[model samples]
Structures are given as structure tokens and as C-alpha cells.
Target chain A: MVRWEPGAEGRLQAAALNLYAERGFEQTTTADIAQSVGLTERTFFRYFADKREVLFAGQEHFEQVFLDGVAAAPAGASALDVVASALEAASAYFPDERRQHSRVRYAVISANPGLQERELLKMATLADAMARALQERGVDEAHAVLAAETGTTVFTVSYRRWMAEGEERSLAAVQADTLADLRALVLAAG
Target chain B: MVRWEPGAEGRLQAAALNLYAERGFEQTTTADIAQSVGLTERTFFRYFADKREVLFAGQEHFEQVFLDGVAAAPAGASALDVVASALEAASAYFPDERRQHSRVRYAVISANPGLQERELLKMATLADAMARALQERGVDEAHAVLAAETGTTVFTVSYRRWMAEGEERSLAAVQADTLADLRALVLAAG
Candidate 1:
């Protein structure tokens, strides 16, 4: 029995991150998060399945950004090009405004193996979504899956580089560079 | 305290897998594994940190195989080629004799998100180990990591294909074919 509360979701998420950062993920509980947000436990449950869910609220939205990008890519684009375009579209989801929060989120995830596993599962699920999106665009099943996985790898490497100290380039710029590096590596492999 | 009983480790692993197969991983317990092996719970703990660890007993040995192959690759080999060679060496770890076990192991892993997370962590660790091994062999840090990761992708795709019903190709052969497919896909992308 949960009721809608305007702005409650964002407030709860911010509170959860703060508590997780302050007390570590394992030490943080649902009640603590709800209390910090001035909300009830039932209200928290309305927005998130659990504490971990708060950290991953954007997984589905990010997946949609990626898939929409693939669908809107120029016809006849190479498979990698389509994936790259999808990445480009998805990059907007992590603008400079969110950089500090992203860093804190990444830090919390890295500090907890449970969170890291959840991150892995999210990435794996996104890869599958990307693959299916590619298949919808007429690519073969095997090639679609590979390209999607490779695209996820590209996103991961670029995200790390983008988060590194003194990094000033946009996420899109870093992604383009890493994609080129991957291309060159693959080419040289043959 | 743990005792060094000859054949105890193998017996425990076999028993754990059997139990996991018969009564799902979630339903199976460490005590059940020990009881089936005619050993005390203390002995099971001595062999495995937990029930999930039993499914991952070969992770370290597999990592060693990859690292050893990287160390032995020719000095002039390209980064991807070096990783391919490592995969070739590691292929021996999953010969036909182990196919049934591997299939059962993968099944148990697929059934549990917790196990899937552990599997992802193990794979990530192995990739890092492979990357470090390549760096030691004179490959640049960036190229080493990318090559190692790509090789892991190749291994994963090939292993899945090999495990499919009626697949008769050897692990090494499937790996060779998959590597070639990746090369072609990347070449086409560029």
C-alpha cells in the first residue's frame, strides 16, 4: 500500500547516496534512507524495490536511450557505426552536471562487491538490449550480439577515461577516441 | 581447523555440483555437500569459502593458463594475436571431458543472479590478470587491457557455441573460428 508523492523519488535517491557514501553500502538500511529523506518506509518501497534499486534507477532509461539511438541511426551505417551512434545518444544521459554524482556513485559501487555485481548485471542487460536493437535493424544475430557487447566494452573504457583525474573532454569525445583505438587494435590483429 | 585429506577436495566439489544439479543451488547447502562427501562441515569450509565457491574452483587454474600462454607468446606477435594464443592455451582447460560438467556449472550459474555476479567478478579478475601478463610481455597498458578483454569476449562466444546441442567441434577449433569471426566483424566495421 504505497501512495504517489511528488519529488519523493529524487529526494529518496539523494538521501540513499548520501547515506551510502557516509556509512558504506552494507551499513546503510532502507529505514535509514527513508528517515533521511523525511519519508516513510512504505514511500521508499513505492519508488524502489530495495536500497540497491535506488542506485540503479536509471538502468532502464539508459537502455532506452541506447536503443532509440540505434533505431534512429542513418540507414546503411556499419554495425559498429550504429553502436557508436547509440553510444553518442546515450552519452547525453551523463552530462557534465552529473559528473560529481556519477563519480560518487561509481565510488560506492567499487567499494562494494555486491554493488559491483549489480553493476555487471545492469551492463549485461544493457548489452542484450543493444543486441536486440541491432537485430531489429536487420543485423545478423551473432554479429548483433558481438557488436553490442563490444559497444558495451567501448562504453566502459570511455566512462573510466572520462572519470579519470584532470579529464576535461566530453563523454562523447572520449567514446569516439576509444572506439577508434578498438578499431585500430582489431585491424592490427588481422 | 581444516585437515589435508587426500581426494577430499575433489569429492567435495563433485558432491556440491551433484547436489546443486539435483536440488537447485539455492536449495543446496554447504552441510549437504559435506554430508554427501562423508565429511564434516568444517572440511567443506576448508575446501570452499561457500557453496558458490565450489562452482568456481577452477577460476585460479584457468587464470594461470591464460597468463602462462601470454608469457610464452612470441615477442613480435601483435596484441590481439598474443591474446588469441593465450586463449588457445587456455582451451585445453575445457576439453570434451569437462563439457558435461561445464554445462551443469553454467546451468547452476544461470539459475542464480548471485552466482552470475560471482561469475562476472571471476571473469573480470581473469581479464585483469591477462592484461597484466600482457603488459609484462612488453605490450602497452591500454592495448594490453583491450586485447585481453577482446580475447575474453572471443572465449565466451566460442564456449557458448561449443556448449550448444549437437556441437561437435573441439574447444580450440571453436575458439579459432570465433576469433576469425571477430576479426572479420571488426574488419567490416572499419
Candidate 2:
């Protein structure tokens, strides 16, 4: 049993995503989101520090899972292998029910420069965390950083493909394909 | 004769860097920057769209040079080789006198999340552009993208090392080291 009930938080997220899609992220206010969700503005604030925070609440948890997975990877695994395993572990955390909402959120983020910047920052933070985790596993600093970056790039490309055409694909499958593509690309270049 | 006035842009960039470092990016207005150089705000705006633009104006010219260099790379040259040549060409365009201002600008940009995101987006855009350029030169799409990403990663790591404390190596030398590091990392992983 999950200790944390995904109730008001999830409701607020769904409400916020709908409103953001309907009225534009910039046009929507906290009060409006709270009112639509039949909650007080205070309730909304309790869940999200700010409007931007709503889009990023999952990042902390995701990063933790990713880092743990990397730390637990095989002793002799390469940095990329560690990161790839971590990405695979992280994939299970993304709920399938939220795919549509996730796509909408990405669309909104893509259109807004401020949101896009925040998204990039989040990704960079995740990469840095992963790099540090790899370093803890005896990987060299530069190799660890490169592996983290490559992993993030693979995730990015795979996520884009998964989101394209509004079609649903297993995160594991997409990630696997992305890694294969990366390996093939590198080999061909070599 | 060169069409553009030499060092005019450099002087403005230097002025902006000093003001940003002294008063912080948000606190230092464009007018403050222009006044420091004995120029008007209009002149500042003419050169830069906003305060942030001053830090990024050279990016376009740099990308153009890189793209041209990549295009002119020898047939059968490895993707890394092409990217390395492009980085070398781009390095020649970065004036030695700008190093101090460049460091100052990087410091300001690093401290601000907003600027950092825009910087990442710009780099992503450049990578995509470089991938497309490579594809146009007969490289497959997936391979081209991966090659471009690898090159960009090397460039980023090299630039960071160049900017790090007690690192007196030339940018070109740093870039070379980064490429070698990347190759070793990838090969070891494989």
C-alpha cells in the first residue's frame, strides 16, 4: 500500500493540466485552478509551491529512483550501462494513465520559453545527479558525466518518439530502442 | 577590407559583462550598460534585443562557422573528425581579448537558471542544426544526430574545463582532450 494518497495532488494536476491546455498556462491563475477543482487556493498552494512546481513535482522522486538504480548497477558495468539500467528502472515510475496529460504538458512547455527553460534545468539536474551516482560506484568523473549525458540524450529522444503521433508505447521498449539506436549510431560514425 | 567594424561589438560586450558582474544581471538595466560605454539605450537595443541577448549574440555567427566547416570536411572523414574540425574553426573566431568577458558572462549565466535554460536550448538547436548538416552530407539521420550529440557533448565538457579554476590550457587543446576523453569513454563502454 502506498503511504501517500495520490488524491488532491493528482486532482489538482489533472485540473491544472486541463485548464492550462484550455486557457493557456500564462492565462491560468492559482485561484482559477483551485476554483475549478472545488478546492481552496490554500489547498492548491499546499500541493504546489507555484504554478511551475505543478509540472515538476515528479522530478525529485524520479531522480532518486534513477540514482538508486545507478548505484545498484553491477560492479563492472560501464557508466552507460549503469545509466541505462537506471533509466529502465525509472521508466516504471511513469504512469500510463497520465500519457495524454503528459503530452499536453509537454506541448505547453514547448510553446513557453520559461517553462522550456525549467524543463531543461530539471533534465540537467537529473543528469548531474546521475553522474554523481556513477562516480560513487568508482566510475571516473569525466566518464560518469559523459554517461549521464548520453543517457539523458537517449531518454530525451526516446520520449519524443513515444510522444509522437499520440501513440502509446512501453517506456522500456522506447528506451531500449533508443539505446540500440545510440550504439548503432556511434559504431557507424566510428 | 572587412565589412564589419572591428571590435565595436567586442567593446559593447565588454561593457555589458562588467555591468552584469558588478550589479547582477537583473539589476543592471540595458540603459545602465549603454551609459557605461557612453552610448544610448537605443544603441544597446540595436545591438542586443534584450539584456540576455548580449551574452548570446555571437552564438549565431559561431554556429554558421561550425556548419560551414562541417560541410567542407573531407569525404570519408569520421564524424568526430568533422566535428573536431568545426570546433577548431569556431575557436579561431573566438578572440583572445574576449576571454575575460567570456568568463564573466559565463559566471552570470551560470548563476541564473533562466539564462542557463536558454543556453541549453540554444545548444540543443545548434546540435540539431549540425546533425541536419551532417545528414545533408550523406550521413544517415540517426547516425548524424548521434554524432552531432557526441560532438556537442565534447564541446560542452571542453568548454567547462577551459573555464575551470587553474586550467590554463588553450580552448583548442581543451577541445582535443575532451574529444579523446569521449572516444575513450565510448570505447570502454562498448
Candidate 3:
């Protein structure tokens, strides 16, 4: 139910991403994207409020993945482990076939400061949601906040590595490696 | 020089804070803040870009403390230790005298969602600065990123505790406790 289905919304998003990447986000307009998909600007507006929404369309489902993972953790799991499970769950959202799309999306975002801020806001929202979920699971508030933030940091580092040139590992594997590195750093605190 | 010196800027900021708290951030205006300080609105603009600037006026020097601490870290310190040094450095920025000012400022920001986003952005920027400083110190990329983010999380949790009603711990003390808890969580990960 989450993938870009062969629907008007999907077609508009695909076209918008392609145009935004090729022509640059600033240089592309909603009409250009809609026209590329053989649709009118009105149709594009019907599906997306504007151009940026195309880049953020999956955010709700993506956040739900993290919340669901946090809720599913065992009662006795450590905060870090609970967060790791959430990070692992997010990997399913990014399959091997979607890597190119992700890479392009990352590029588009990197090229725009506004998009970058929006991306950071989205991550902050995810952290807040994960912390609340953990709290609901009977985790203490401070621990939940710390672990949820740590989860976002791991996801950020892993996401960058996944998008790095010539990187072949899956997002889950990269996230695991990053999580391990974080634990090692924490354990090695002098 | 940073401790709200007895000058027009300091008076304006203090007055703005008090008025924002009493009247609410949305209800207070620049003219009201200026008039409270017996200054003109034009004079107030000479000191702050806008009302929000009053809340963030100390951010630059605050960030400098982190960068300085990171730069001055002993060559062999662990990444977490380096981050701890930075966190300790920042504590001086929030002495007991400024605690009430901070509490009021926090309330004002908390009352407005936009201001909260700005605060998060400021924290994210601090993390980026600390990460770069760590990398410059030859710490590995992953470790630097993770430690810097962990440092911000410690700061956030500790600051909240510091601002909590009936809480009396120094910011640095709270930070140490939070850091220790995080390390414990990381060590206990399974």
C-alpha cells in the first residue's frame, strides 16, 4: 500500500522527482512536472499541495514504521536496542530497487537549503514520535528521549553512507553498523 | 561580556522576556518590549533582528564554547569524553543567576511552535558544528557524528531537567548524569 503505485499521484511524484533532479528543484515548476506526466497542473495540485509535498509524500507511513517498531519491542529490551529495532524496521521502506530514487531524492534535498530544513524538521518529528511511543511502553521519559534521539542520529549516519557513491550495503546493514559504532563509542567513554 | 550587561541591548532583552512571559509570546510586540525598557522601537531594532532574536541572542557564544572545548580536548580522549568536555564547557553559559531568565525564555518558546522549531534548528546546528570539530581532531567520521549528536541529546535532556519545577541541580551536574545514563543504556543494549 506504500510504494508509488501506478496512479496519478505516483506518476506526478515520479515525474517531479525526475525533473527536480535533472533541471534542479529551483528551476522546475509544478506545471513542468504535471505536463511531463501528461497531466494538468490542476491534477498535480489535486494530489499534492505543491512541489515539495512530492518529496515528503511518504513521511507519514515512514514515521508509522518507527512508531510500530518501538511499540513492538520486548518489555525488557534496553533503550538502545528498542531504538535499533525501529531503525531496522525502517529499512523495509527503502528496497534495493528504490536506491536510485532515494539517491536522487537525497541529491535534490541537498541542493536546497529549505528542503534540508524541512528534512531536519521531519527527523525531529520522528524522534518526538518514537520517544512518545517508548514512553507509552513504560520506558522512563528521559531514557526515551535520549534513545529516540540516538536512533535518529544512527539513521542519519547510516542514511548518508547508504547514499554514498559505490556503497552497496542495504540500509538495514548500514544502520546496524552505525548502531554498533554508537554503542562502542558510548562504552568507550573515558 | 555575555551576561546580559547593563546596557540598552540587555535591558531590551530582559524587558522583552518579561513581557513575553506575562503577555505571552504572541501577545507581546516589539514596541511593547521597547516601551517597557523606556526605549524606542527603532532602538530595539538596533539590537535585535526581531522578537525571536531576543531568545537566541546567546547561541553564537554558546556554540563557541562547544567548539573551543572540542579543540582543546586532549589528543587521546575518547569521542564521548571529548563531547563531555564540550558539554562541561557549555555549563558556564548557564549560571544560577541566569536560571530564571532561562526558565522564562523556555516558557516563551514552548508557548509558540514556530519558536520551538527554531530552537531545534539551533540545536541541530550546534551538533553540526561539534561534529566538524571532532572530525578536525581526527576522530573517525561515524564516531564524531554519533558523539556530537549524543552530546546534543544530553544537553536537551539535562536542560529540561534544569528547567523543571523543583529541580535544583546545576546544568553540568544534570548533563553528567544524563551522559552516564546514556552510556549505561548503550552498554546494556542487547
Candidate 4:
């Protein structure tokens, strides 16, 4: 017989998200989150460094997915194409079931400057990681950084559209539209 | 008899930047900045909303230059072209004499997460203004936004490159290279 141990981290995160959505991020406490998840406050602290860390727990996973996607891009692709393909792969990792909660969390984070800064830092770190991955794929440093920045820009636009529209379209579609828009903008400028 | 008036805001910003560069953003205080400018603390407050505002006082002027340049772009020019033209015009606004101080200020701001967030907000606002200007010139809203974002991306890349090499190249040349790189990335991707 297999034993079913408590998924303390997942439960704490789910509880924190719910509480944050119901009340607010600033209003919620680690104790409240711990109690809701039926875990001790100590256990909660053991899982997350702080209450805010619960909201950002998936950042590491996001980085890994993006890096792996970039690594797997075709060898002949240009830096931009490689990045776009990686973003497409990363998009598949975000599901519709989680979109509502993600939007709510984003709203909470956006309303707070500190949280917004943390989010930006996280995104910047991700951009750096993508650039490094591109460099490993044989792209030069400057072009690799530009490619990563371009990918981040497209992701930002697509995510904004997705969140604003309640995730009605697939993430891939939104990303594709963003890439096309980028191309058209450049060609028009020329 | 004649009366003399001082540019209080400019003096305060200069003082603040000097302190920030010599010491650091975290080590500097409003009082030190005020004293260095030969003004009372109250006078500094009257000129700026806070210490951070001193560093950002000129952002509006930059935005205006960019918008004006975009508006004056030749007819039938693409959105990217308009944005590139705006960046070129804006580049002329940055004084050669202030390059060293500007570099120091940039380093301080980049090193501080709080300042970085504020900087991002400012850039986002400028991009929004650029998009609005483009829309006023008959471009569609979505396309205008994409164009503005692309332009900002190029400007950022060019500015970073210029800073990276200690301002050896003219801002105009760097801006041109950035636009060319962006266009090439997009075309290669397509």
C-alpha cells in the first residue's frame, strides 16, 4: 500500500491564493494560510520563506520550462525564431483552469509596487536565463540578449491580452499574433 | 536694482545626482541634497514630491521629444520608422557634458530594485504616450501600441550599447544600429 502524505506546499499555495483573492495580499497572513491548509505555521514557513514566496513558488518551474524550450529549438532558426518557438512551448505550460487564479494574483501584485518590482525582477531573471540559453545555442551575446528581450516583450503583450480577455484564446494564438504584430511593425518602420 | 532667481529644481537634481554618484542612492538623503543645492529641506520638498522625483524630472521632456519626432515622420512611413525617428530626436536632447553623470545615475538606478521598477513604469508610460501619438496620426490602436513597444525596445538596446562602450559612438549611430538589428531579427524570424 502506498502512503498519502500531505502535499503541504501545494495546499499552502492554494490556501494563500484563495485568501488573497477573497480579502487581499496585504491583509492575509502566514497563519491564516497555514490554518486554511490544515498545516502548522511552522510547516508553512518550512515550505515558503515568507507569505509572498508562496505566490512566486512556480517561478523556478517557469524558468526551467523556458530554458528547456529554448534549448530544444531547431539549430537553423534565427535568434528571434528560436525565442518565439520557446515561448510557444512555454505557453503550453499555462493551462485554462489556472488562468482565473493567475489573473487575480496578477491584479493583486500589480496593485502593490513592491510586488510589481519583485515580478519585474523575476521576469528580468527569466530574460537573462533565456539569453544564456540562446548563447549556448551558438548565438552571439548581443543578439542573444536582444532576442531574449524581444521574446519577453511579446510574452508581455500576449499575457496582457490574455488576462484582459479572460483567456478566451489559446496562449499560443496570442503569442503568434504578438510575433506577427512585431514583424509588421518592423517592416512598416523600414 | 535687480532681483536674482535660481532654477531650484535643476539645482536640487544636480546636487542629488552628485551625492548619489559619490555616495550611493541608499546613503544619500533629502537634507544632504537640499544643503548641497544651498536650499532648505522645505524648499526641496516644494520642488520635488520626494527624493526619487529628482532623478526623473526630465522624463516628460524626453517623452515630448519622442512624440514630436514620431508625429513629424514622413507620410506613409511605418510605425517602426516613426518610433525610430522619435528616438533619434530624443537622443539629441541628451547633453554630451552630462554623459559621465548620466552613466553614474544609470548604474545607481539599475542596481536598486525600487528605482528599476519606477524606471520601468516611466518607460511604459512613454511607450503609451508614443502609441497615442501614433494613433492620432491614423494608425490603428493595436498596431500603434506594437510599434511603440518595438521602438522602446530598440531605444533601450541602443542606450545600453552606448553605455556599455563608454559612449564612444554617437547616440544617433547606436540608435540606427538598434533599429537595423530589430528589423533584421524580425525579418529573419519571418
Candidate 5:
């Protein structure tokens, strides 16, 4: 696979975002993104299948980070505890520096219903992956699914908060707080 | 808007299911469905937007039933209670008689990635609607989101179980059991 020259990926991503935001997503083409980034269209395609994928390219790594966390959770942790550890592990994928890129990506996605639906499907996929990872660790099917789904929910709420225009907290901090809130709400049902 | 005859809707749905099962969702056309039910293509168009919409048409009512429950929850109930109440209300929409229909629909959806993604987005939409309904009842935004998201997760888990092959429990009964399970799991964290 052709990799980006050092720091070139960021330049290409920035150019694509500017173009996608300036011109409508439908009207933009790979050539436009490539030209704007001073890279060949062949180079752009080498990195992403299409212009639309520019927004989704990081999803695999994001999920892998969460799955790694799940796989690395301490043995004997409760299902929810394992999920929490995984969530915290995934948070490192979104550092303080990456927030603006996410905010812009969220903006681009929010404006299009198809993109928003894709975003929802993407989160669901992450939950399924996490559940599978949990099950591999000997968690029962139901417990794995429940823990993963709820963990994904907490992460989504926190990620959205973290991506909010004025919110400044790290995804890890926001997610930690959200998980506690979910626990309190669930415990309240007892 | 044109309406189906007293039994026409059921007949159409049954015929569509048979065709979709035999020919697959992608190969099945709206005309094929209408013809199978001995209705004109015009009648088919009147009831559903497309072949795919036949599987999705009931979603609007499903979300509405849950929202009504949220709206009518006993005054001053806790946020989680309100969500649970809404979930129970929605259960009435899925009686034992509807089980086979759901089973077939779920099969059709699971076999198609596009349909599966749409299903995920639909569930996400339900959660958002539930959250908005909770907020209207004076629950704080954060509490409303956490409760609604978790409630939707529970409902999804229970619904999948209800639709599983050879599963005989009513959606309501299964949901109640699942809700209790979720409560136990959450409480275990304390």
C-alpha cells in the first residue's frame, strides 16, 4: 500500500475537508481532493477508495483501538468493567489535537441524512465488534452484547460531547463521567 | 391517500414475504409483490414507497407507540422508570401473533447488509425519539439520553431474542425478563 509521506496525510485530510465543506459532497470528486492536496488522484485512491471514504477511513482503527482495550482488559474483570477498560483504551485514539478534525467530520456527516445513517451503522458495528471481543474472553453472549452496546452508547454520548463546538474535555474524561451517569441511572432502577 | 382493503394489507405483506424469501430482497420487485397478491402495481405504490418500504412501513407506528408511553408515564416517575414504561407500551405493538411476521422480516433484514444498516439507524432514531420525549417530561438532557439509550439497548436485545427461531415468549414477557437482567447486571457493578 502506498503510504502518505510524513505529515502528508494531515494535509490531504485538511484539503479534502475544506473541499467537502465548500462544495457539496456529491459535487466533489477524487481529482478535486487530490489536486487540492497536491497529490495525484492515484495516491488519493491508494489511501481511500473514494472521496466519501475520506470521512470513514479512520473507523477501522477507532474500532481496533476499542477491541484492543477489550482484549487487554484484566482477567476476571466484570463484563461491564471489561467494557469500561476497553472504552478508556479507545479514548487514547482521540487525543486533544484530533478534536477539530472530528468536529468537522461530525459537521459534514450531520448535514447529510445518508452520512448520518452511515454514522449510526458504524457505531452499531463497533458495538458488535466489542461484543464479539468480549465473548471471546468467555463472557456469555447476552452479557457481552449488553455490556458492549451500553459501552458504545456511553462512548457515543461522550464522543459527541467531546466533539461539541465549545466542549473541551478529553473523550476519556467525558466517557468516564457518562459511564458513571449510566450506572447511576441503572442502579436507580433497583 | 389510498388505503388497503380490510384484509389487503395482510395479504400483501404475506405475499411480499414469500417472494422476498424465494427470490431475495434485491431481486424482488414491487410489481412482483403486487401481482403475487393479485393487486395492481398502483395499489402497491399506494401502500408502500417501494419494495424495501414494505419491510420498514411499520417502523413509524413502532416509534409512536413507544413515544406515547413516554408521554403518559406516571407523573414524577424517575427517568429510568419512564423509559421502562415506554418500552412496555411499545411491547403491545408486537403480540405473539406478530411473531412469525417479525421472524421473517428479521431474516430478510439480516441477510442484507444495507437492510441491517438501516435497521441500526432505525433503532438509533427510536432512541433519539425516546430521549426527546423524556426531555419533554422535564428529565434533564443527560439523564434522558443515558436512560433512553440503555432502554433501547435492552429492547433490541429482547426483540432479537423474541424473533429467534423456536423462541416462544411474547415480546412483552421477554422484554420484562430482559429488563430485569439488565438491572441485575447494572446493579452488580455497585
Candidate 6:
């Protein structure tokens, strides 16, 4: 009988992360991850398509959060404002507790070209989704795309800071700060 | 005996594009491309690693144009200004002559997820390189990354416009228009 627990996915992810950190991502196997989680390999496949999916399982959920935030923004909000609100809401998903896990995952991802490619695609997908949401809010395609891309950059830079050692700021705070910096950069260019 | 001649790369690319357009990307084979170009399969391999590479052979040269532009910007130029100049310079590489080829290539790429992932990684790589160049010019890390990413977005939006049917404007013109739109979006959010 297959055992399905309330936190089976989390347990699998935690086990995968731990194994990846200890043995390196390339060295870790699916069976190792499953064994570490005290789950069958069949259960592992049920949650993730492969070992790589464990590291990126949150991408769809995160993209949905960003899209929802954009859709829920005030009707009168500017395109960039809607993106900022969306990024702010999305950042809340990465709490202080996730910093260490994120750091480990980042390291694993950075060392693998395949993982890096997936990461880029995930960000691109998020940007595309956000752009569509902005357009649905009556913004032009040009503005929508720019705002969505800018929002992704803000999230990336802020997330990097939030994951850095000795960095204690929340992801939302860092995102706001980076957004200000981007505004200054834009104004200076203009 | 191999018939090695000048413009072999260009010929191979043209043949690949024609074949891809006719038979679709997945259905076209490297042997067909080689035969169409009147070259041996070995000659095609010498020019491009694989079929997909024929469409992306100029990426390195394009990156060089952008980087050189960044490096040549005035000493007092802001990070964003450097990026703008880089983009302006890079836009010059995609002249009107390449528009049709670009459109066809875009269609082929859009139909394949693997190609889309590769395209996203290529853009990310460009952004990363631009950010590093900005950092080398004394820009702060946050500002550098934001400027680089925004520049990539500008290029993407402008390129799409330039590729659209019935669009006759120069790439530089489209890029300037998109940059203005981005500036307005940023200002509104600010």
C-alpha cells in the first residue's frame, strides 16, 4: 500500500535538499531521496517527474501567486504598480525559514547547466504570465511586458540579497528597495 | 574530398531555415540541410554543432557587440545609460535584411519547448554578461543587475516589434519607443 501523508511532498523536498547538499546534486539519486524520506520511489514519482522537479516544484504555485496579486491590484493602479504589488505578495511566500533551503538550492542549481536552464525558463514563464495579467488589466502590451520583466528582475535581485549570509531583511523589503533602485536607474537613463 | 568554400555557414543556415519552414523544425534533418546546401554532412557539422545551432550561430557575435558598446560608453554614463547605448548598438546588427529570416526562425522556435528553453537561457546569459560589464564599470550590484535585465527586456520587446508583419521601422527606433514606454511605466510606479 502506498502511504500518503499530509506533508509527503514537503518531506520529499526536504530529503532531496538534504541529500543534494550533502552529496551534491549530480551525485544524489532519486532512490536516495526517496529512502531518505522513508517513502517508496513510486511515491516520489507521484510528487515529482524526476529529481530535478523536486527543486522546482514551487514554480507553478509561485507564478499563480504573482498572477493573482496582479489581478487583485487596484483597478486604477499603474502597470508597474500592479507588478510591484504582485512581486510583494509573491515575496511573502519566501519567509525567513526558507533562506537556508533556498541557499542550498541556489548552489545546486548554479552548478548545473540543465538546472540553470530550467530556472531561466521558470522565470520567463513567470514574466509571461505576469505580462498577460497586466494586459488583462487594460495595460498595453509594451508596458505590460516591461513591467513584468522588471518585476522578475526585482524578485531575483531581492531574493539573492535575502539569501545572502548575514542578510536579515524580508524578501518584500528587499524587493521594495531594489524596485526603488530600478526607478532611480530608469530616471537617470531618461 | 570536402568542398570547403567561403560562406559555408551562411549557406547552411539558409538551407536549414528553408527546410525548417517547409517541413517544420522537428521533421527537418541535418542531412536534408546539408544536401540542400550542396555540402557534405561533415561540412554542416563543421559550421554548426547541430540543427538548432544554425539559427543561433550569431549569438556570440551579438553579445560581443553589446559588450563592446557597454565598454565604450562614456566614463560618466549611468549604468542604465550604458545599457541603453549597448542596446542601441546591438540593434544595429538586426538590419531590415534579416527581418524575414528572423520572423521565420522565431516561428520555428516558438513551436518547440526545447528551443524556447534554449532561447530563454541565451537571453539570461546576455543579461548576466551585461550585469558583469556594468559592475566592472563601477555600478552597484543591484543597479547593475536591474539595468542588465531591463535592457534584455527592451531588446526582446523591440525585436518582437521589428519582426512583426508590416513593421518597417528600424530596430533602433522600436527600441527607443519601448525604452520610453518602460521609463513611463517606471515613473508611474515611482
The interface root-mean-square deviations, each candidate in sequence, come to 1.7, 2.6, 1.6, 1.7, 1.7, 1.4
lDDT of each: 0.85, 0.78, 0.85, 0.81, 0.84, 0.87
**Candidate 1: clashing residue pairs, number:** 0
Cα error of candidate 5 at position B108, Å: 0.9
Q: Distance (Å) between predicted and true CA of B30, model 3?
A: 4.2
The per-residue C-alpha lDDT of model 6 at residue B36 equals 87
Report the number of the highest-lDDT candidate: 6
| DockQ of all candidate complexes | 0.58, 0.42, 0.61, 0.50, 0.61, 0.72
Residue B27's lDDT in candidate 4 = 94
Q: Is the docking of candidate 3 incorrect, acceptable, medium or high quality?
A: medium
Most accurate candidate by DockQ: 6
> What lDDT tens digits, residue by residue, belong to model 5 across residues B46-91?
7788777777777888899999888888888888889889888988
Chain A, model 6: TM: 0.93
Cα displacement (angstroms), candidate 2, residue A114, comes to 1.7
What DockQ number belongs to candidate 2?
0.42
Among all windows of 10 consecutive residues in model 3 chain B, the one with the lowest summed lDDT is B1-10
How would you encode candidate 6's per-residue C-alpha lDDT over A70-185 as one tens digit per residue?
Answer: 87789999888899889878887888898888899998888887888888888888989998988888988767877888788788878888888999998988888888888888
In model 3 chain A, the worst 10-residue window by lDDT is A1-10
Worst 10 residues of 4 chain B by lDDT: B1-10
Which scores better on DockQ, 2 or 6? 6
lDDT for B4 in candidate 6 is 67
Interface RMS for model 1: 1.7
Rounded to one decimal, what is candidate 5's iRMSD? 1.7
Best by TM-score: 1
Where does candidate 2 clash, by residue pair? none
Q: Per-residue lDDT for A36 in model 5?
A: 81
